[model samples]
Target: MTRKAPDAQTLSLMLDNVKFDSNGLIAAIAQQHDTGEILMLAWMNHEALEETLQTGRVCYYSRSRQNLWRKGETSGQTQQLIEARLDCDGDAVLLLVDQTGVACHTGRKSCFYRSFTEDGLKEISKPEIDPGQLYARPHKH
Candidate 1:
């Protein structure tokens, strides 16, 4: 089915049904339209979700960092949001974004590189740039 952009009222109504996780979170999945390629999946708190809609930018709650973060804030591969949708269960979200560059923090175009196979797993994509070179200094081993 062709999903049209939801009106603000519809978006608000949809938000009410979302079931936040134990930590008051929901998973947000980003994807590219032309390719139907999933970019990355991250968590979002109520605040983050609202902010993302308000700003037209994808923002997610970083569990490890314990804060809200705008995707590509550090990497410069920011995703300009195209649309956001809640799944039937409302346990997850799907974001269509106009991606600029790499989407994964690993410097890959997408986070979903490892594909399961009968033999094992295999990488499907290569890094666009070295994370250390594109974002910040690498941690010392």
Candidate 2:
């Protein structure tokens, strides 16, 4: 089924309601739409957010690279936006997505693979695929 794009007035209002942090960014969390699995946490700038809304693809602002980082640009694990939500304070965004392949660069399904236990930090999950196979070339974080 096709979804209707938001009108300009609606889009403007929604964008205005978001509260970007001092660096003109907001914390964005990506979750598996059907399973509710927390995939990863990233950051988004105004342009990235707008593009995600417009294109239905997940995009983030790469703090390490200081530029827009489209998810799965290098790796093949792209995220299709199922829904986007703003937190009550408007300082965070929750993205419900249909993720392709693994979400973490380490070849795991999710980034939250390490668990803090009495034994200290432990890796609770093993990589589903080799990390080196995720990207075709060297990627910056």
Candidate 3:
């Protein structure tokens, strides 16, 4: 469903209801809006959550980098937010997004490229593009 950005007051109310973890971050799951395909899961701090709700772009907290990481900032694989939903407990978020290019650092369409089957863990999907090709330009931190 198409979603209009909520007004600031409404958004603030929504944010106030979120139950962030002790680390001050919440788990956010991004999915392809139309296909409902799970793309990736990431952490979102308060700033990331607010910016995503305001800008309609998915931003995540980079635990490794210790900074805010905008989707597609370096790889050109942006996730444009179509809608954002908080879980019943308000501790998790689901992002319906229009994904551009790929959503995985491994150059796969999604981070969930593996699956467990009767045979055991199996590689369900192959990388569409090479990581080197995706990050051809040097990224300056």
Top of the candidates by TM-score: 2
Point out the higher-scoring one by TM-score: 1 or 2.
2
- Residue pairs in collision within model 3: none
Number of the predicted model whose lDDT against the real structure is largest: 3
Model 1 steric clash total: 0
Candidate 3 error regions (>4 Å): 138-141
Candidate 2, which segments miss by more than 4 Å at Cα? 137-141
Candidate 2 residue pairs in backbone clash: none
Name the TM-score of candidate 1. Answer: 0.85
Write one digit per residue (lDDT tens) for candidate 3, span 1-141.
556778989989999999999999999999999999999999999999999999998999999999999998888888899989999999999999999999999999999999889999999899999999888874432
RMSD of each: 5.1, 2.8, 2.3
How do the residues 9-128 of candidate 2 rate in per-residue lDDT, one tens digit apiece? 888889999999999999999999999999999999999998898888899999999999999888878998989999999999999999999999999999999999999999988999
Error of 2 at 92 (Å): 0.2
What is the overall TM-score of model 3 with all chains considered together? 0.93
Query: Which residues of candidate 1, in runs, are more than 4 Å off?
Result: 1-12, 137-141
Q: Per-residue lDDT of 1-141 in model 1, one digit per residue for the tens?
A: 443445779668867998998999999999996799998998999988977877777889999999998877776778777888889898999998888888888889999999999989998888888988757832221
